[model samples]
Target: MYGVDACPNTEEPPDLPALGTLLVDTSRNNRVGEFRGGAGCYWSLRPMGGGTEWEVEPRHVRLALPIEQLRARTARANARSRGDIL
Candidate 1:
C-alpha cells in the first residue's frame, strides 16, 4: 500500500500509519486502505480468523523535494494563514 489507513467499522476512515508500524488490529475482520494519489480509500473485509491472511505492502512511495522549495512552501502557507504575504 502506498498511503494506507484504517477504517473502524463504527466510525469514519483514518489516516495512514507511519514507517515501521502495524496499522491493523488482528482482532478485527475488516478494514480500509487509503492510497496517496487516489481519489479516496478502499474497503477490505475478510472472514474472521485462521483462514487466509493477506500480506501488506512493505514499502510506500515517497517524493523528493528540494529543501529550499519545501521551506518556501511552508513559509508561504504560514504567512497566508496569518494574513501576511512577502
Candidate 2:
C-alpha cells in the first residue's frame, strides 16, 4: 500500500497488533518486542531497548502485561543510565 508494488499477499495476514505496541512471544521464551509491521506471514518487532529487529508469527505474540511493560521500560531506562544503550 506504499505505492510501491508489493507481492501478491498470501491468504490475508492474521489480525496483528498495531505498530509500536509491546508484545511478547508467548509461544517462545517470553521474548519482548515492539511491533513494527508485517512481512508475509511474519511480523517485525524491535527489542524494547532498541536493538536488532525480529520476526514472529501473529499466533506467537500477545500484548505485554502492565508489569511486563513496566519491567521492560525500567530495564531500558537502567541500561540507558548505565550507558549500555545510547
Q: Of the candidates shown, which would achieve the greatest lDDT relative to the real structure?
A: 2
What is candidate 2's lDDT per residue for 11-80, written digit by digit as tens? 5557877788899987669988888998766789887775888887777778899998988888778878
Cα TM-score per model = 0.23, 0.75
Off by over 4 Å in 2: 1-12
TM-score of 2: 0.75
Relative to the true structure, how large is the alpha-carbon lDDT of every model?
0.34, 0.79
lDDT of 2 at 14: 70
What candidate 1 gets wrong by more than 4 Å, as runs, is: 1-65
- The pairs that clash in candidate 2 are none
